[model samples]
Structures are given as C-alpha cells and as structure tokens.
Target: MILGYSVTDLVGFFAKGLDQVINVVIMFIFAIIFFGIMNDSGLFKPLVKRLILMTRGNVVIVCAMTALIGTIAQLDGAGAVTFLLSIPALLPLYKALNMNKYLLILLLALSAAIMNMVLGEVQWLV
Candidate 1:
C-alpha cells in the first residue's frame, strides 16, 4: 500500500545517489592515476624542483606556493591533479616547520573554495 510505495521511492533515490557517487569516485581515481603517471614520467619534475628551490626552506612561502598551485589546478578544472602534485612538495616543508598538519589541510580546502568561486567565470571564458 502507501508504505510499500514510499519504501520503493526511497530505495530508488538511494540507488541513484549511490550510482552518482560511484561514477564520481571512478572519475577521481582515473584522474589521479593519470596525473600520477605524468608526474612519474618526469614531465613535471623540473617545474616542481624549481619551485622547491625557490621556496628555499620557508614554510609560510611553501604554504602560499601550494595554495597558488591549488588555485591554478582549480582554474585548470582539475583539483585532484593539483592536490596530488602539490602535497608531496608541501609535506617536507610542513614537517620541517613542525607545523600542524591540519593547517595545510585547511588552507587547501579554503584555497579550493576560493578558486572555485573566483575562477568559475574565468573557466567559462576559456
């Protein structure tokens, strides 16, 4: 009766949400693997190395650098790729500074949010 119909509708909605989540996860995994492969190919090492050298052991500067990278990555419409690439570089600086791990995490989240909001229009133009 009514109860059966409601249950069916709830189940259908749950299934659709699950499917969307699965698709998103699969897409993320593929993007990560592709970015990782590119990094491993030495395509990005020169750029990353130059950045590391430029930072010169400064934690605040390193954090800002990662934030900039994250923003650029978002502008390129690939947050995951930016995160995957920037994190390894940032971690050593974070450790060296004895900074709280959560600070970097929070900065990343804020940077992504700001990038998405500010860059959304710019992305559409390109």
Candidate 2:
C-alpha cells in the first residue's frame, strides 16, 4: 500500500527540516553581512596595501603565501576551518593584485592536501 502523507504531515516534515538548519542559515546570513560591512568600510584595504609592499605585487609571492597559509591553516586537519582561515585572509590580496581567485583556491586545496598527507605520514611513521 502507498503511504499517503497529509498536508499537515508534509508541513510538519518541512518545518522539522527547517528547524534543524535555521540557526545555521541565520548565522551564515549574519556572517555575510558582517563581511560585507567590513569590505564596504575598507577594513581590508590597509592589509591589502601592506601585502602588496611585502610581496612587491609579485604573483609568485601570492602563490607562495597561499601555500604557506594553507599548510598552516590545515594544521588542525579540518578542511572547513582551513578554508575559512585561508580564503578570507588571501582573497583581498589576490583581488588587489588582479590575480585569479580560482588559482588561489586551487593552490590552497593542494597545499592542504599535502599538509594532511604529511601529518598522516608522520603519525604512521611514529
């Protein structure tokens, strides 16, 4: 026999699903707004400027920095946390230098993977 779910049952199921993730959705919205406000207020501008001077507007420095930060951020062995730490810190620099965002992301991912392997290898060796 086919199961028939009434309107109330469907609505309840939908509400249950929404309730489970409503907090996350709200927090995500606030985070986006916060970052937007910071960007609009130019909070990252000075950081971008300093990075330009330190790296001398070098594309290779951006790549090198991305890899270093990615590896350091991955120390905790959490991809989400690593990306959260690396992306925001590097995105402004990449954009300021007119570099490709995809390249930043690709390099971050590769570095993080290498970091994970190195950590795992050390553990296995021990």
Candidate 3:
C-alpha cells in the first residue's frame, strides 16, 4: 500500500534481485577476509617501511608512493576494495612518519580515481 508496493509485491521485487545481492555480500566478505589475513600476517608492513626508508621521510616521496600503491591497488577495478586494502596497509606508515592523514587519503582517492578512469573501469561493455 505504501508507494504502490504492497508487502507481497516488495517481497517479489526483492526475490528477483536476491542473487545479485548475495553476490555483492559474498564479494564484500571475501575482500574483508583476504585483507584481514594480509594485515594479520604482516604482509604489507615491510613494504611500507621500505618505502618510508627509501623516501627518507620526505613528505613528497611518501605521498607519491602512497598514490602509487593506491593506483596498483585499483588495478582490479574495485574502488572500495582498493581503499580497504590500501588504507590499513599505509595508515601506520603515515602516522609513524608524522604525515597528514588527510593527505594520505587524498592521494589515494585521487590516484585511484584517475587510474580507474584511465583503465576504463567505468566503461560499459558491449
């Protein structure tokens, strides 16, 4: 009765989209678990630490490396997943180096957006 959709009608509509909904839910769960394992196993810490050492604590180098990491992270064309994966890995480094958290997020967002566009991630398939 509300918005021309009775309860049964709404149920039917939801049933129609159930598979797509389930797939997204599963994807999110898997992404979270995968990233969790990486974080738990200390997979990314060394990389970030090395990058910090290589950059010699220069803000510019750190930001550029962060962007590069974000760009590589987006290669799979999933922005949310990229952010979920990159942010945790880089967050500690940003804090340790005393860099601005805003800058870290900004660089990641910008690089991911630009790389996604360049990689035709948003292009419709024929």
TM-scores across all candidates? 0.60, 0.74, 0.65
> lDDT tens digits, residues 61-110, model 2?
78998999999999998786777667777888898888999999999999
Query: Clashing residue pairs, candidate 3?
Result: none
Least lDDT summed over 10 consecutive residues: which range in candidate 3? 117-126
Candidates by lDDT, descending order: 2, 3, 1
C-alpha lDDT (0 to 100) for residue 116 of candidate 2: 91
- Model 1, CA-based lDDT: 0.70
Q: Which candidate tops lDDT?
A: 2
Candidate 3 lDDT over residue span 59-85, tens digit each: 887788888999999888888778877
Window of ten residues with lowest summed lDDT in model 2 = 23-32
TM-score winner: 2
Better of 1 and 3 by TM-score: 3
Q: Tens digit of lDDT per residue, candidate 1, span 19-106?
A: 8789668867886687667756866666656655787757778778667767776666566656665565565456555777788777
Error of 1 at 15 (Å): 1.2
